[model samples]
Target: MSAILPPSQRLWWKEPVERIEIVWIAIAFVWCLILTFMMPYWHVFGKQNLSNEAYRTTPQAFAAKAQAVVDKWKVREVNGVPVVKPPAGADIYLVGRLWQWWPAYELKKGESYRLHLSSMDWQHGFSLQPVNINTQVLPGYEMVITVTPNKAGEYTIVCNEYCGIGHHSMLGKIYVVD
Candidate 1:
């Protein structure tokens, strides 16, 4: 009765499949089609989807822009890193370099900011902890995402990509205050 028998001894093709088997196969095919259509549908209508807003820019230009923002609204320096507190609704920049994320950010709770991210030398992974926002940072491209901090606390920015020997030390911070 098994189909795996030798071809000379078995005529499995002549055997009729059961009605339940045919019904199951049809159900599976329809389910697959439904699942295939759901992917693009959710991507177009989902509320918590990733932004497709990005642009091309050089590393030097991006660094300059980030430095300017730092110099303009830097409240203080912590361990030689500037902690910038740009006003809500302003543009905020974060740069990923060889082994660090430059300059920390301070934002107000419930206010939105346009966060621009880029890398200097290599591809980096930007993973904001606690809130769990993850994105890829490229060297020659600038990626922008609008973020609103809904809670007041200290959040850590961890580089999840392995760049070099010091990758484990590549960390940044963001402080959200009321």
Candidate 2:
């Protein structure tokens, strides 16, 4: 490679970097250090963390629990689907199976609810559209999602994960009432 360059230009690589280049290099190093310290600092001090609360239960056991929630809340059949309007600050249960999300709920606006979501057959997605809250529903694991609807409207719940040929038909609803 030295044979391709003239003798006068061969000493360029031996020279030190300029002062501005050194300053930029130092700046980049400090920036990297700052970024490296951010994650642990956030974990210790920030109010942001992933929810790791989950429990193991069979599909049958979960179904019984869901039925208890439904029976206790006075579930009504709306066009062959169950719809429950539980009292304020009540815990709600939702069942997800192949191509279906059962027992739509009616929630009071500005009231908090603990939604216990589980799957009966396969992995599914709990996606509330228009509001855009999404979470995964896995079989044998109950995932709890806490939400308080601030706006009064009907939010469509659709499965965002592909489960089967009728995956597109997996839909539900949550009515946020005034």
Highest lDDT among the candidates is held by which one? 1
* Model 1 per-residue lDDT at 130: 90
* Model 1 root-mean-square deviation: 3.1
Q: Specify the poorest-scoring 10-residue window by lDDT in model 1.
A: 1-10
Model 1 per-residue lDDT tens digits across residues 90-137 = 989999998888889989999999999999999899999999988889
Model 2, span 1-178: residue lDDT tens? 6667675655878877799999999999999999999988987897544356788988998899888887877557766778889888787889999888878888899888888889999999999989888899999999776677889998888999889899999999888889
The reply for model 1, stretches above 4 Å from the true place, is 1-22, 25-45
> What TM-score quantifies how close candidate 1 is to the native fold?
0.82
TM per candidate comes to: 0.82, 0.76
lDDT for position 65 in model 1: 96
lDDT of every model, 2 decimals: 0.90, 0.85
Report how far off residue 148 is in candidate 2 (Å): 0.8
Model 1, residue 86: distance off in Å is 1.3
RMSD of 2: 5.0
